[model samples]
Target: MNGGILHALLEFAFYYPLVMSLIWMSGGIIYFLRWERREPSRVRPRPLPDYPMVTLVVPCHNEGAQVRETIAHLASQQYPNFEIIAINDGSTDDTGAQLDQLMDQYPALRVIHMSSNQGKAMGLRAAALASRADFLVCGDGDALLDDYATHWMMMHMLESPRVAAVTGNPRIRNRSTLLGKLQVGEFSSIIGLIKRAQRVYGRIFTVSGVIACFRKSALHDVGYWNTDMVTEDIDVSWRLQMRHWEIRYEPNALCWILMPETVRGLWKQRLRWAQGGSEVLLRYTTRLFKWRQRRMWPVAFEYVMSLLWSYTMSVIILLWVLGCFMPLPPSLYVDTLLPQWHGVVLGAICLLQFLISLLVDRRYETRIGRNYYWMIWYPLVYWLLNTATSVVALPKAIMKRRGTRAIWVSPDRGLR
Candidate 1:
């Protein structure tokens, strides 16, 4: 009985990721052929009949270093009829002064200085309340919005009233370190592919927190951003979808954002992300059992299975470590730890997944292929890092006090 259970664990550990990779690949290919490839040019956003007034909300906390460049990029956007709103959420640095200086340079740029440090969710809510436009485009203070990104995202919003929000594509800008370089590929191969696949399947897991556009009406409908949620983006994505509002993935809406170059930064970022996801799952699990939420069943199931897979891998690792000190059964010792044909096949599939994603994404990101070599080793790195974080985050999610406001903190913006 013990051997049988161990075999099943090993099988799940090997095949679950393999199965998910294939699903993402097929769905991504289908989406490209059906929607993406049909577009005349991914480089340019299609011209619209009417340009709606859009307020670009930028919430900042100790981001003086990157704010100027971020605003500079937004000023160059191809989309017209838009205003810039920069919320200086109690920055200890000169972020307020910087925004004020930029306001003098750009007439349309508005600055809001909060007396105390408010979380991003509250900052966004405050921005939403103060916004003059019905349409709101929000991004990180450190992100460089592509010239055509606003136009691309707005096109989707204008196309249908049902589209409550449109998520932009985030491209990593800093690649000075090995960790940074791997993340470049990770975004294209793992994150980008997953978004495409999820979009094709009728629901996205979350929008890119770096850049996304939301309708003011929809924001009000869903109660704006949740102040207590660690990840406001993920929390809003679930709320909007649950209300029957559509959230779209717009690859043409590109934003250049920085990522963590150090191990500590990366671990912290992923831990928060994992915990946020777990919190959403726990919060919505009961609501999803109803007949009305049948579409969300697959997403919920996938998340649960991923959690189980992480625990299973943990068990395997624990047993392997124990085996180092004490004698173990021959069958268990030989079969559990070593990579056999299953590992070889899984590795091959991972490589294939990277190839397919890079090929599809190359037109939008011309230099993505340069990082392909780094991607070859991404599975090993990704598995260990993400699995560990997922395990650690689940308990944190469960124990977290509900309605507690999650404060904003200065994150590692990578090496300058």
Candidate 2:
């Protein structure tokens, strides 16, 4: 009986990732053909009679060194009618002093100093409160926006009044280390491709936190960012979209941001993301079941299935480790962890899918082509790391006590 059950679970554990890979790859190809092949509309001039006033909010917490560069990038935006608002959310460092100095340099710069660390969502809320503009472009303290990114993102709002939010394409800024190169490939091949696919499906997991634009009216409609959610970006995206407001993906609005170079940093970053997703699943179960809230069914169902897959993988890993002491029937060979024919074929499919995506996104990114060799080894790295994170994060998400603030640790910015 144990053997039969083990075999069933083993088959699922091995085949499930392959199945998901095929689905994502196929969806990505179709999206590329239908959408990416066409020329982007950002280049065409709208020539607005009056450029709408925009408030660019940079929410900070202990970002003393990095925040200055970020503000400089914001100040240099090509758009004519926008202002930069720097909110120092009680940084222990010289961040408040730095912002004060910057305000003197940039005539349009405004500073908001919070008395204490209130977290990102709170800082953004404070900025929104002070803002009189209808359009708000919020970027993280660590990211640098392209000069025309603001203009491109704002165009979506101008073209469509229904658009509540716009997510920018975040490129990795640090590529001085091996881990950085791996992430460059990961973002271009996995993150960017998946987002395009989800958009083609009329659903996106989140409007990226690193950089996104939100309409003031839409923010009010959805109640703005949630302070308690581990990932406020993911939470806000769902909230606004659930209210039938549009969330757009503007690939042209590129923002260069830093990524983790160390294994510990990468693990913590992904764990937070996984935990946030799990928390959203837990919090929205009742609301998702409402008769009128049917549009979110697919995203909700996908999360549930992913959770089940995570749990199953965890159990199998534990049992396998235990079997190292007390021998059991092998799922594949029982004696060896060698790559079987099925594994090889699935791996080849993964490679093929990656190559296709690379070709599709070749125009957008420059250096990723040389990093393709590292991508071949990413599956082994990803499977072990992602599975471990899921196991740890799922429980954390479930047991999280209410009213606990979602403060964050500093992310590793690679070997800069």
Q: Name the candidate that leads on TM-score.
A: 1
CA lDDT scores, all candidates in order: 0.89, 0.82
Among these predictions, the greatest lDDT belongs to 1
What's every prediction's RMSD, in angstroms? 1.3, 2.2
Taking the tens digit of each residue's C-alpha lDDT, what string does model 2 give over 1-416? 77687678768767877877777787788877775567553354345555799999999888887988999999998888988888888788999999999888999899999898788998899899899799999999999998888887887898788999988888898888777887777887778777777777777889889889999999999888899989999899888878988887777788999889899888989999999998888888889889777878877887777777788877776775777778665652244345788679777977886787678666667556887888877877776788888878889998999778987566766678
Q: Point out the worst 10-residue segment of candidate 2 by lDDT.
A: 329-338
Error (Å) of candidate 1 at residue 92 is 0.8
Candidate 1 stretches greater than 4 Å from native: 329-338
Q: Between which residue pairs do clashes occur in model 2? A: 330-334
What is the lDDT for 208 in model 2? 89
TM-score per candidate:
0.98, 0.94
| Clash list (residue pairs), candidate 1 | none
lDDT of 1 by residue, 286-376 (tens): 9999898887787788889999999999988887887888888865553356567988898899889999988988978877888988876
